[model samples]
Target: MEPSKSSDDKQVAPPRRVSFKYRSGPAALRCLSDGLVYFAKPSEFNDCLEAKFDHSSVADYIERMDRSIRSVSEQRSCAGGYAVPEGDLASFEAKTACDDVNFLEATQRVGIYSTASRPDNQPMWTYYSDNSKGFCFELEWPDTVLGRYQIAPVGVLYSSAARVHNRADIFDTLIREEAELHPDWSMDQILEETRSEFFRFRFQMLNTCRAVSIKHSDWSHEHEVRFVTPRAGPLPIMGQILKRVYFVRTDFPEWGPVMMLLHQLYPTVELAKMSFQHVEPYVRVQGMTKKLVPVHE
Candidate 1:
């Protein structure tokens, strides 16, 4: 069990600030065995996370994960022991040693997220809304539905912090375009959604500290992700997960200290609707993390 870090203990030593940049392989979810605990059986595990993957698809999640793990290690070895080039100051959370300009143009940093609250599992998916976001999550024990659950590796989110504020605004424009695409929705509805999302985004940003999305390229996934770790099979492809209802647990003591307000919510909530006091509590308490900053961002 991950012992709760007493406030005083945190003052003594915190885990090295979790790299918001996701690292796959043994680093992210940490290991395949730990990730399997979230699954009920092996078949389901294979479906949701078999990195040795057997099927073929446009985006072979596991294959990509496997290759990424190897490639990143190689880059580190060749980096001459430097994490980044000495002078760039680019987003350090996720990057390849090359420092390609196209990489930045293709990606956007909207929120800065720290690592998910520490547990054996990392954030596979959590903190989503109808405009839901997931890829890491956890549930406490003794719960009727999901017991303590989580997956590893982590991903980037844009930071709402002052330094990145301008970049975040640039990223929000995508939401604006998405809002425009929905001609039938009302202004109040959109603002309410934005109001609550930003509230959660701000809080989540405070929690994790970065959310960055980059364009998909054969080479990029190798060094810059922690979200899927060989990826999940039973778990749906991330592209299919947006804008839907999701259930979130509120009683988990596991989240107790990580979220200062864990006791503030009821229990499971329908996250997508965005119209209830119950659901809003999580946005504050456990903001659903986006799967990854989508490639389009």
Candidate 2:
């Protein structure tokens, strides 16, 4: 009898199974037969997770993978080095040595900063050695919602004993001799006239005695000071105020102590009133260009 149209449509297809070859290495195959741990299976004797090698020749590849994993783990753990306590400047200063005595020792003895501050919201402190290199410490604040954070080195301070005495003598002599020579010029006028000289002298003294020097020169005597940057070129300014006030404060209380404060202070009283503006559109364009361009070595 002939089959019906329904029977023809109901014809069955053969079953299909997907399979892959399992090639064993000499070491792994040997281990499998000897009841030893295979690379693909968990070992009964040890709790450690290890790649079972089929051959001893693949030991180098296993070692390389192990090293790479350990390196990545270590880097993640050391993402933030250390944190600074949140408190008044005085309290923070007191704990300077405690948080890391090793850092203090290195700074004082070898002129190096080993430990860095964790980045935090509270005003962070960064230690600088040789006035150029800086190490930041993170700070923790109790009142903020963010909890704690890190900050980079934004300022520096220095002190020197010899600078104090020398400055005193030089200023005294200049006042005496200049007053006698230019009696017509008032004390204020003389100071205004020789401001550049005073700045140069101060800079030289600091360079000789201190490890680091702030990057500013005084041209108070000149009608205008030129401000230059690598990317921005020269900055505009008013007359008779040629140089920016770079040094915040300096103190020479006695022969042994000479304190200098260096910081990213806000502009002086004059610049505060000027209409300083930034072009956000230009900045955005620059940022986009940087992102899209692929840098080549």
Candidate 3:
């Protein structure tokens, strides 16, 4: 199936055909043996504001709130020939507050497996690869298992400011206008229809690909790509997709075990040593132990 397009119908193009994953020695060993990678919850990440929703368009939220209140008021006025109850008004206010809180909290369920477009990034090795004591795996993504899980790697969008999720931007007035198209429908019918459409719109708008693919500009150096899923756990990886392993430190305590495991489990995988230079480009990969197969070949 084709990827679900956004309102603008655009997709995040991969920087290159291949992406890289940085892992500690133990994590690399585990992944090499089990052919699985962990998809961590957004909250588990170093970012304190991971998956936090900032729906700060007060005017838009109030506009929708007023429409809801008016709908209830009209219904109550018709039903008992009296004013809407104070309790019901309070309930509406409470529900609005709850929705905001729930949106922010629900990000815990989001699963993210982060990758980078470039393998040569210095900080990537320092921060993610146990300060270059671990290793990095260069893999071809969109493999069978990931595709089966409907997980696609999307390029992350970097912004100088926090991503502000405006409710008005997502659940646009199109649905309301669509409901208005049905002039013959009663207010009750319209309300029911609008509520149903609203939920459907929310589901489409709250997509993992679109919602979590954004980050603060501070992370721009990572050139990050992410395989996002609704659930967090060990995601299966097909063996053949792991093309190469680049080890930064031969002195890593488990180097022997890691090398042995790689040789046994992935004999055809090219092994390379990465080095740091004092020149302009600090990080470089050279001297592969195993010959790299030409892609076209």
What would the TM-scores of all predictions be? 0.21, 0.15, 0.64
Q: Candidate 1 — worst ten consecutive residues by lDDT sum?
A: 236-245
Tens-place lDDT per residue, model 2, 201-243, is: 5433332222221112231111111111112111121111111
Ranking by lDDT: 3, 1, 2
Expressed as tens digits, the lDDT of each residue in 1-297 for candidate 3 is 122132333878666358899888888887888988788998788987667656655545656545654544364453311233565867666775787676655556767888988777788888788888889889886556565875657788888786776554444344455445776655566556656856655444344455677788888999998887667888767385688888878777877778777767888777777788999668765645532345773
Q: Write the per-residue lDDT of candidate 1 for residues 18-117, one digit (tens) a residue.
A: 2222222222222112322221222332123211111122123223433433343343342211123435435342332232232232222221122333
- Clash count per candidate: 51, 17, 0
Alpha-carbon lDDT, every model: 0.28, 0.24, 0.69
Better of 1 and 2 by TM-score: 1
For candidate 2, report its TM-score. Answer: 0.15
Model 1 — TM-score against the truth?
A: 0.21
| Model 1, position 250: C-alpha lDDT score | 33
lDDT of 1: 0.28
